[model samples]
Target: MTDAAAPPGEPEAAVTDGPVTERATCLLAPNPSMMTLEGTNTWVLAEPGAREVVVVDPGPLHEEHLARVAATATAGGRTVALTLLTHGHPDHAEGAERFAELTGSVVRARDAALCRGAEPLVAGELLLVDGLRLSVVPAAGHTADSVALLLPADRALLSGDTVLGRGTTVVDHPDGDLGDYLDTLRRLRATVIDDAVRVVLPGHGPVLRDPAGAIDFYLVHRAKRLAQVESAVEAGHRTPAEVVAHVYADVDRALWPVAERSVRAQLEYLTEHGLI
Candidate 1:
């Protein structure tokens, strides 16, 4: 949520130009909003000789979005075998059920309430849909329900909001904790370092390379922000709003609301640790 320029690493990905008709294609929604985010990236993944398609993040419940996704999958001459959610945020899940209804596909997610035929997706769970394998990785932090899907064949991760192509993600307290978030980053870093992950297809924003570097930068940024918040609190900025003004002075005011949530999380962490 900081206004700081995105740390350099991977090149930006272009929006999907046309219908995704091949094995690996992505369609970016045209609309981008604070809620929708750089438009949810609906990934259509297929494997060699596969007869079905896998849809990652059905995005908002927008009729047009679902229609586009269906059209793209149908163009590939395959039925939508499954719908996967990285997390249960409405932006990412609101349309999952509806999309499943439209495509007659079952939804697989860590949160069953968010998808079809309730199944908890724990880490290291592999799902095979028409020979296209996606490994569920529990990356809780952005939300308690957050998870990332790892496609070993493609060496790609559908990171959802746990990682992003633009700015860093917010850690809303109560459901979002900085400690858990940092742990998730560390785990993701190990995956990146092992060269197991080649690219990140996030819930919002474009795709990115250098998954390890991006996760590292995000961790470092969070540390720096925590320090700044600690310093601000020591320098007489105690309330969340006051800390936001001081610690995030350079960040765009439009995003301060989101920043405030992270700031509150940091404050709780500090208070729990007797740092304030």
Candidate 2:
């Protein structure tokens, strides 16, 4: 899910499809909307001088986009060795099968159903492709199967929808849990501190330079929103819709449907912890 709010203190830039780092390039997809800011960011990652590269989040079933991702990954005579998904969201994984067909690469994801010709990703597993080392980090909040990839060499974290480049991501309730998301955020904060992550290559919007600061903002934002939800509940907001209308009245009505999902997750969290 996506957030309508822009990231606080982040400098906005023209988000285009191009290289964001020495080892990473972002191909901005064509699909843009209130949810998908700019578009889904399809990342191409490889170690410098490596003959094989990995593609992350193939994006929607847009044929041209998939073809472009394949072309970009296979440029300079390098082969697209693997396709990885941050989650099973259609915006991120819909093009996986098509892209795999175009690039002849194995598709791997946390969800077994999403994997094609490859095993599901195991948390903490090191994916050594050519010379690039990507550490699979289980990030289950946006979705049960969401994951983040850490590129130690580049000090970069490929944060799918868990930590967006701009604004925040939706905790798609039922499938997503707020408690789990909060835990994921805390874990990611520790990972950033311990691993010295400097940049975040998000699934959408622009690249984030200050990984710690971004995550801190997300944590603070979540806490504030949770408090608001709890207050709304105490103030007689009985349903998710009522909570959304009360807590997220300022947010675009177009986003309320998704916001309700977050409220549901938060309500569940509060109920489980006996906070409400």
Please, what are the lDDT tens digits per residue for candidate 2 over residues 86-128?
9999999999999999999999999999999999999999999
Which 10 residues in a row give candidate 1 its minimum summed lDDT?
A: 13-22
Relative to the true structure, candidate 1 reaches a TM of: 0.93
lDDT of 1: 0.79
The models' CA-based lDDT, in order, is 0.79, 0.90
Off by over 4 Å in 2: 1-5
Error of 1 at 27 (Å): 1.3
Clashes counted in candidate 1 amount to: 0
The C-alpha local distance difference test score for the whole of candidate 2 amounts to 0.90
| TM-score against truth, every candidate | 0.93, 0.97
Go through the candidates in order and give the clash count of each. Answer: 0, 0
